[model samples]
Target: MLPAVPDRAVDELGRTEGGPETLGLLVRDQHTRRLLLLRAVLDAAESAGPGVCPAAALARLREDWALLEEAERLEPSAHRRGRPYRDGPVSGRPDGSVPVSEGPRGSVPVSEGPRGSVPVSEGGAVPGNRPPPSPVRALLLHPLTGPWARDTLRALRSGTGPLTGRDTREPARALAHFGSLAAVAAARAGVSYAVRLTAHDGVLTLPSLGALRTGGPGSGETEVAVVHRRGRLTLRRPGEADVVVRLQSGAGAWSEAAAWTSAYTLPGLVLDSAAVPLDDLDPYRTARGGPRPDTLSGPAVLDEADRKHWLHTWSGTAAALGLGGERRLAEAVTLLRCLVPLAAPPGSVPGGAGGSCSGTRREAFGAVLSSAPATATVFAATLVHEIQHTKLAALSEMMTLHHAGPEARHFAPWRPDPRPYDNLLQGAYSHLALADFFQRSALAATLPTLRDAAWAEHARYQAQVGAVLPALVGSGDLTVRGRKFVDRMVEVYERLAEQPPPRGHAARATAYVQAARALWTRRHAPGE
Candidate 1:
């Protein structure tokens, strides 16, 4: 069952962004929500009862589910933190299942929810807001969202009133592919597990772990025996043995080498025993950095050197993030399972001045789509900012914060054009996190020059969020509770603003706020 959220927790998220319990609860809740989707998918297929589902695939699906159950059976801590597990749906129902709908990407909002902001993904053209993944784990494989899992769940339930299962074909087949999670779960629970893992586009992409590039063609189905035991995760196939790169230490190579059958597998990143893949090889994630600042929709392959560059950049980013705050860094690491690199545009100046974004779906909850920054500090800032969006996106699933539609009608300092109310909330929330980061940095900086730079950033985002609060509170778009949430945010701004900004920044921060609105007014209003 999904954990119940306290009303006060909602207010606390608004007031303080989030601390341990709040953040932990959000992460824990996501893990539960993903499980809920997995269960619902199982139910939908079983109720179809072998008559509709392909018999062989159906049996495998049951085994797949069984293996996951076995992982829990052997180790119940599968539900606890630091255990394992995303990239699926959220539960709003008593049974912890999402009522299937026929809208855009799985869940069709019958009441019409707002579309998410577009970014580095999908040709830099705007894609719809990525709400919670519609609980279908299949969406995790392919980058595209469509409709069809025919005779599966979408077709089984008609006019179910609001959710959409047709976003992809063969969702049941997709569910079977989900069997790949069995080994991942077992390793996480520190128990032994073995299961036939399905290859997606010639790869077994394990969410928290890494992918096994089985060297199969894109046109067919291939299965590999994925086994986890004694702190090791291994993939076995026919005629080929792929090498594994330990993403993080803790894992040992399998002692049993005789198990064979995975076909033509190529060496890739292998994660076991609590290792999380900071991956770039996964197809669903951006392979190369694109123009979009946050999300990368397009996919490309990075050469070995490029891959090395990413590892180096991340190593630096992780170290720099450590300086932010001990507890905050720990929470960030927990919430941040992986980082996908965002390629810097040519001629880009040194340091952060680039884009990065956190995941919006259940399957990708702890991941971020980011660019490689030259400076560690700016890179850390991008993470701090993006993680806030991650937090808020998860929170939005827990509570209805605003009713902003698709239309852009509000001012956001971060955006040039007007933004939708929901988008505005995301920006304010993230900027608050940034403001806090800068505040801490400014205080910690020893040099006068460094302190000034940090405080300027602190002043800019702090003022920006505060100036925009009225639009959020008065916009008539936020729900009553959402207003209360924003109200707490206003209080936070006031408390932070009371300390005067460094020299030249009070006016500069005010101008930064005024300048953004002025530019927005000029473009949006033009005549005014």
Candidate 2:
């Protein structure tokens, strides 16, 4: 498990009097609120079993107002509405359920306040009327009640929020753990967490804490309540059964039976307990103004066989790469929170597709699994490659790399179109990680065939990097610091490049990548 934040530092809320602007940029914009919340919870959890007080949590938010504002400014305008909520037919309610009506868009206007401050009501209810609406309910009714509302409720309920502590390292790890749990939970359910914020009269409705009536895993369970008490999360009567499952700290475990039995039928694939089988959702094909091939729609069925297959591949790959430990897996899962399984498009190769969102959507990291069956090695390499992209995206938010401007486009070895300096950097960084993965796999493989394959992969990636590095090094678009960062990356790549692959295979791998590059340039490059 990752190290815990010290009580005093967490209590202090990790801020300094006046730090360099670049220091603030080091942390990704999307992660600001979450990082603060997790650190606060860790501090509170350590002090008392029940967690921190609501008032204290609110105060902590005030302290981190600056960071929160910066994050908000950087968030994409399209996603400012928080998670997407769907308006559809209702399923049967398990128990203790209330009727939920879909209201008009912008039914409730969100009141603005200073960055992280809870939006306050303009006026109180008349004395003759029923008592004033609960602040929490009113806040929930507002459209913008996303991270602010969630964090405040957690703090109010658990008495934990951000602290005044200056320690950043421990809190970062705790946030990573928190992210991992959320990702694992999403993967298990075959559905991303929908931020369903609704209000009937003065009552507030939050779907995340409420039971999902979908007939999938835990579908039979009439009501599933999420309880945060004593620094732990509990799912009461999860699945279509009468059993309670506790999500322990650091590592999370779920009921295998519940996971297998639950199934959600969606547009493209049926998400069951174990595996996500691809359907005609046509997720592999990208179209203009339409959802990306990786975009998920509707409910998914959870299949036991599929889920087990996925877990086996995931866990087995982790073990093969010596990353099978629970904490490491959790971190990887956290980094790869979204999993979209895609059906291969016409004339397309069957392979995994990876992507990471920019700006405030950094946490929205995900990959689309191919319809084809792949070995554990393929899955492992894909995971490492995609997660590395996510890591770089997050890092880019904090530091200036290439100079900002429209610069001449250069060929990215992997892509057909010319890319700007930044996109080139992204490809290079991800391929570098791929090369490293192959290098490590080469060392770890026991079978001669597998070992040879790993070497071939390493050489392929190395050559791809070599093809692009010269352009990156010579480009005037890079800042001095950015150039230095690239230099360090080159150093690592050069060291690995020296490790020759199996004799004949090395030359063949290099030739293949070079030939591909030449073909791409011929097809896409502008004529002199």
Candidate 3:
């Protein structure tokens, strides 16, 4: 409902610390054409089977890297370059779907045929120098190997993995160690999995697994078992990283979860070795920014006096807008708390920096509130507006869970009921944007500064999301319906500006939204 500012442009594209200004800017016009072509290979690898497409993609990437390296040698800093984060094997799963396990679905039995009578090397290598019967097995059993797990190993040595990076047995060695039982058990206990095993030196590259599960450190019970059809192996180490031995599944279809859920929600799912608890991240300590306070354990409770004061302030603004009523105020407050806490990651406390969710932690509402009417009105509008913005995040998570499988219950909010149009998540945002616009206009004279700041923030967020509307609507292009929705919101903002705040109940809020939307339709037809 807030008028969008025209100056803002949304940039969701990823950038590195010292990369080129843009991909296009990195190379000359003719060379830029070649870059786009090369990018296609990366995309294909990302989209297609990593086992199949990565080899080709990696070949192309390496070729390009060589050219760039050569160019830099001739003229240093000729093109923007950065220490690139290796396009590690894509999660071995397509984007948008829950990686139900560390590797692929399906189960493979442990090979019982023979341990190979060949003398196992003192370092687990065979002495005869005869190639092992199974190259994949050799890689898995070899100690000090790296991340070219069974899947990549098969692809390289046996034409079964993606062809992107080194195919030598070096990666195999890294895997043999981290993929061992000791590493797997440690990972399972929820420790950081992807530690720098070694720095990438020219001859030897250090490897890091995204996540691993191992046994209790120093405790015994160490062994490795391949699960999900040899697609993935469970590595258990008592106190180190837990390594998942995921193999190729030959399936290329990609899907995403409708919503994210707690780890417990899904049974037998593998946690990425890279993921650590949000609270555990960014520990409070004295540094360049000064001493940071430890985050509280949960949403802090407000004293009764503070609660009453807040209620009184919001109630007055609600009354002016004809949205006032004790029950409605209570409902709104209750909804605010439920929805606000939802913004925090599971187990997060106030002031914690990292979580599955991103964004700076906001101060508690009670801490910043006051008893003045203008203060109350501004607070009310902002609260309503924020509640609206949160819906999109909720919906995104819901969609993720829904896409994962039927078992994920986080998407219950989106189940199609008889009145299927009721999208609490979307509706909450839509209504709040409208309401905030109106409330801000009413208090313009008394709190001009707050009004402007709030409106600016609203507009910024709107612009941030505007382009994504078409994607959300699933039309791949903005449809008439979507345009009308935007138009109506704009109209309502104008209309609310013309009228005095109403003092009644549901009728006022309902009437205002209706008039605004109707005006929007009249001004712009669905297509127009």
Cα lDDT of model 2 by residue, 1-528, tens digit: 112222232111111000112112222233343343334443443343223333332232222222222222323331344322222211222331222222111111122211111111112111121222222222222112233333333433332345544332222222222222332232222222221111222221121121222243332213333333222233443343432333322123233433212221211111111122122221111121324423222223335565555555654554544421222232232233234443334444434343211111232322233332355667666656555565556555544667846554687767666777887887787787677668777877788888888888888888888889898888787876666667766876787867777778778877777787787778867782
Worst-scoring 10-residue span by lDDT in model 1: 111-120
> In candidate 3, residue 523 scores what lDDT?
50
TM-score of 2: 0.49
RMSD of each: 11.1, 18.6, 24.0
* Per-prediction TM-score: 0.68, 0.49, 0.22
After best superposition, candidate 1 residue 438: deviation in angstroms? Answer: 0.7
The lDDT values for all models are: 0.55, 0.40, 0.28
The positional error of residue 516 in candidate 2, measured at the CA in angstroms, is 2.0
lDDT (C-alpha) at residue 113 in model 3 = 17
Off by over 4 Å in 1: 1-8, 47-53, 76-169, 186-196, 206-210, 216-220, 223-276, 283-327, 345-352, 355-363, 526-528
Candidate 3 overall lDDT versus native: 0.28
443: Cα error in model 3, Å? 8.7
Q: Model 2, stretches more than 4 Å misplaced?
A: 1-30, 33-302, 323-373, 404-408
Order candidates by lDDT, high to low: 1, 2, 3
In angstroms, give how far residue 24 of model 3 lies from its true place: 44
- Worst lDDT run of 10 residues, candidate 3, spans 9-18
